[model samples]
Target: MRDKVVAFVPIKLNSQRLPHKNILPFGDHSLSWYIFKNLLNVAGIDEIYVFCSDEIIMNYIPEGVKFLQRDSYLDGDMVQGHEIYQSFVNLVDGDIYLLAHTTSPFLTSKSIENALLNMLSGKYDSALSVQQKQTFIWYDGKPLNYDSSNIPRTQDIMPIYMETSGFYMFKKEHLLTYGRRIGFNPYFQKLNDIEAIDIDTREDYEFALKILETNKQIPIC
Candidate 1:
């Protein structure tokens, strides 16, 4: 029998850019709570597990969300993602895993569902979010995506993608092989500007709130 698809959220309380980022007030609930609630709306996910070492986040976790208490040592800001990700794959039971973060509030459930559908299409080994850029790109004082000899019109510039780290979906085998979130031949799904907003600084946090409120993306209860 094929195993189930699980959504994994690795959230930490410590932050340098924004203090107590995970549980900070983001609208009605904390930042983590907002994201967790959206994850619940997504269908086809058998389990939704949140791995955190902080006790404050425990208060916001509602039903359908499994809380995994992580080791305090792993809570250190210096702890890398791969270390925790490898542990998650080993400890969690799932054939496919969707890795999401609470900080990227713009990543809605619909985007995740679409990404998963594309991921399971069998054209790519993995899938992740990105932002499209269609401006003049330079590398080492040289033009990229344009021929220096025949500098094309600005409108004709080929677009490039910026990995947003908003969300990622990968098979267990890919995680076991590379010990990373993405694998070779990973598909990049470009997101709209609003959907690509990642909160790291105070400016970003404020901007995200504005976007959510202006668009009425906030869930009504």
Candidate 2:
């Protein structure tokens, strides 16, 4: 049997950009619910833990899911995600750990399943969701490479990888040693922009709603 995998979702009510974004309803469910539900559905994921600060949000959580109130120090805006991830790692002892953000509502179970399969089969130390993009390269408000003559087509520019903040998987031991979801040896799983949406601002939340509405997948309940 495959080792049990524990998933920790970090959430907080306070947000400078979009307050209470996690509990905000996009369709029939809140943004956090979408992510939590997907995590529950993924194969090989043995447990799902919501490391949150708000108590009201806990009431809506489905039965069987675990909730861990975040420490005050880790609840601050300046706190890094690595700190919260490590805290949960210490609480739950699992073979593999998956850190997912509540803001990423577009993430699907299949995407998570594939990532897990790749990690186990490929023997990767860690894996993260990324967007494979290779558009015009720019830096510090200046175009670094505008001439396509020297470089290959945008599709062939070695595929610039951007962390989508969608999902990350790592071995428990590797995470504790490296103190990051991405361990020493990390692998990337590419996701489309639509599936990589992370709600940080009002504009982002609104955009996700539009996408779900257009697709007619918005939960009715």
Candidate 3:
């Protein structure tokens, strides 16, 4: 039997960086509408659910998508992100889980479907969306991904993989065993800067709006 792919979006009303970030209006719908709708269009996803604490979120979701009311305590200010994720995985039963976020509105369904197909192929234990960057990066006051002594052209340098909260495809057993979305062997799904956009602040939201306004390739609702 094929593994069941369950895609879910876990959201909370509290947002210190961008107030009500998930529900903020984007085009004709809320910010989260795009991801949810995008998932619905994917053929690989067996089920789609919005795991949230508030019932008001239902207003933002489209028809056919299900809602799973999560425990309010999971949204506590002191609670860690992993704790909340573990709780949801424990509650819902599925062979595989696709952890998606509302902030990543530009992640195309083609990329998502391709990642899901890879997971179904059984070659990879998990998969994550990442943006490849060849720009200079520093960590702990030291150059990373490139040697400073022999600085090379940006395009010639080895690219760095930065994780995006856009989506994570993992087997249920892998998550239950390691308590992490990325497994021992993870497939890095490459995404361009536009597709990897994660709206965390007001500025990011504005930038996304600008993209939608100018990027005719992106579907508008």
lDDT of each: 0.80, 0.79, 0.88
Q: By the TM-score metric, which is better: model 1 or model 2?
A: 1
lDDT of 3 by residue, 138-197 (tens): 999999889999999988988899998899988888778878788888888999989999
Question: Candidate 2, residues 141-162: lDDT per residue as tens digits?
Answer: 7656555457667765654688
What TM-score would every model get versus the actual structure? 0.91, 0.89, 0.94
Q: Whose lDDT is higher: candidate 1's or candidate 2's?
A: 1
Ranking by lDDT: 3, 1, 2
Query: How does residue 138 of candidate 3 score in lDDT?
Result: 93
lDDT score for residue 8 of model 1: 85
Residue-wise lDDT of candidate 1 within 28-94, one digit each (tens)? 7778886677788887788999988865677875677888878877777788988877778788888
lDDT of 1 at 50: 94
Output the lDDT of residue 131, model 2. 89
Q: Where does model 2 exceed 4 Å of error?
A: 140-149, 218-221
Against the true structure, candidate 3 reaches a TM-score of: 0.94
Between the candidate structures 1 and 3, which one is better when assessed by lDDT? Answer: 3
TM-score of 1: 0.91
Q: Which residue window of length 10 is worst by lDDT in model 3?
A: 212-221
